[model samples]
Target: MSPISILTFVASLLFADLVNADRVLGAYIFQRHGDRSAKAWPPTKLTSLGYSQEYRTGSFFHDRYISDNSSYQIDGISTDIVNLAQVTASAPQDDVIDNSGEGFLQGLYPPVGSIATETLRNGSTIQSPLNGYQLIPMSDVRSGSGSEDNTWLQSASSCSKAKFSSNNYFNSKSYHDLLSTTRGLYQSLEPLVNQTFSPSELSYKNAYTIWDLLHVALIHNSTASFPSSVTLTDTVMQELFVLGNEHEFNLAYNISDPIRAVAGMNLAGEVLTALNETITSGGKSKLNIQFGAYASFLSYFGLSGLSSANANFTGIPGYASSMAWELVTNDEGTGMPPHVGH
Candidate 1:
């Protein structure tokens, strides 16, 4: 999809049904960064379209929680007025991830009115140059060995156990089965892969890279840079894409080791933390919290049973897509908590 269209797709598919519960005390949003150039390319950053997409996501939240008549508004906050002190956002210390949060915050709390128009005692007028643009803060969580908060936000690479499982999965019986099943299709795609990357050999192990290239080209490139020989139909591309996605899901989360669940839990742990804090504080916790993470984590989260009760957690969330979790008290008056992931 083009950058513009992906924004609309994300809005309808991801954030449309986030607030269908009773007394949505607060919400936590985990979003994948918006579209960008292929990682293989140097200086991979958010494109103009990506900025627009992320900004739209931020704006969507602003309207839902910051606008007048918002059902999910935070306490001690006014409509059409944002309390920057009450908001919290975090992402791994990567430019793309950082910029994603920044763009979203800009749209969520854009400056609407002048800061000040003051006249000094000496008849000198001092005016602020903010130009009605509000500057909100976003936290940068450390990845790797630096901090624990980013373990899930950067899970795919940070989790050593998941990494070990990934390597083993590549050589497991299941991997062999998948390879045999898609052998024919892989053969057909061999030339395309080679033409694109010209790697030493295009095997099942590295097929996802080829798919990534094709996926990026399909969305970002037109007939200009895309090769004429690379003539895979939409059906063919979809099959390959699904195959790769399934492979990634299995590799990232479904290994035989129990540690495979670490990536999912690390991120979900934050959600649970927020929920618990909110519940403990009499539901007066921060209403909106956003964290950016990789897409593979989304898949792992889907299979982690956190969203199993949720029907909308059927597939992987798309680019700039987000999953919201609502914490609500049960109607039984027994004081049991029901944490709903949507």
Candidate 2:
């Protein structure tokens, strides 16, 4: 080959290598919440024991990340995405266990006549403590009663309309039918959920769990006295504990193409920006960003509702504000070039 040609070839090779170097401009992450007890409802709320379970779940995340290891760290200039908005139309109402009606109460006490006999049988009681205990006789307890006639009127009233309708609104069949419809809706969206991430992805199991947690937290922040800083701290803590393990480390290491990695990061940043915008906007809906389910971008970010919301958002089409960069050949290498024309 001629000297000039040889020189040109070497120069092109070097340029290609330079172009291939990864430059991460942004990133977007959508994650599901960590594991949680079933949704608060007749069937799902934590039993008296469930309260402990909830605390333990919270403690696990807290200790794993917040106290034990400060693991969530990233390189380069980028943006973080989080949804601070309240997306749930309603809060989780009193669980059904708390509202089993008069029958539940009746079961706790002995039969109306039996209670008096038991109180007398115990004997040692100085005077059977009746001040706090308001037990109605079994005969007096209302039977064949509708919901309103139930013993725990106050408890029943605390339940939300959604819960009441599902449980007490109609008989068990009506409740089951409503439940079926809800399940059907969820099943229809199953494809989108499955597509959001791959099984091999880091924290895949925790992704959906985290999403649900965030949803719960968002609701708490909206209706209760939860501090935003506490919620944010909880979020960061979970990310560090859950996503900063060896699995993700290896996955990050496996990417041989620097430009693709950088592109992925940039895409992640865009998502973060959108999420931040959604939170700051004070709207009821969450920011939904959908990449193919296999992408795992949301899991990477440690937020959840984005993908779920993406699947359901009626106003915006899929992947709003998404920027596509072209894999182009430059003097450097296979690099993503900023596309000028759409």
lDDT for position 150 in model 1: 29
Candidate 1 per-residue lDDT, tens place, 1-342, comes to 111122111111122243343334556777677777665453557767778888998888777666666755543444444555456677766666677778887777776654445678999976545655666676655342221122222243566765676567778897888777776777776555555454344546555555666777788777556457767788877776666556655554652464655656666677777766665655456555555544435444555653355433333355677666654332322222343231
Clashing pairs in 1: 111-132, 111-134
Q: Which candidate achieves the best TM-score against the true structure?
A: 1
Q: Which candidate gets the maximum lDDT versus the true structure?
A: 1
TM-score of 2: 0.18
* TM-score list, all predictions: 0.76, 0.18
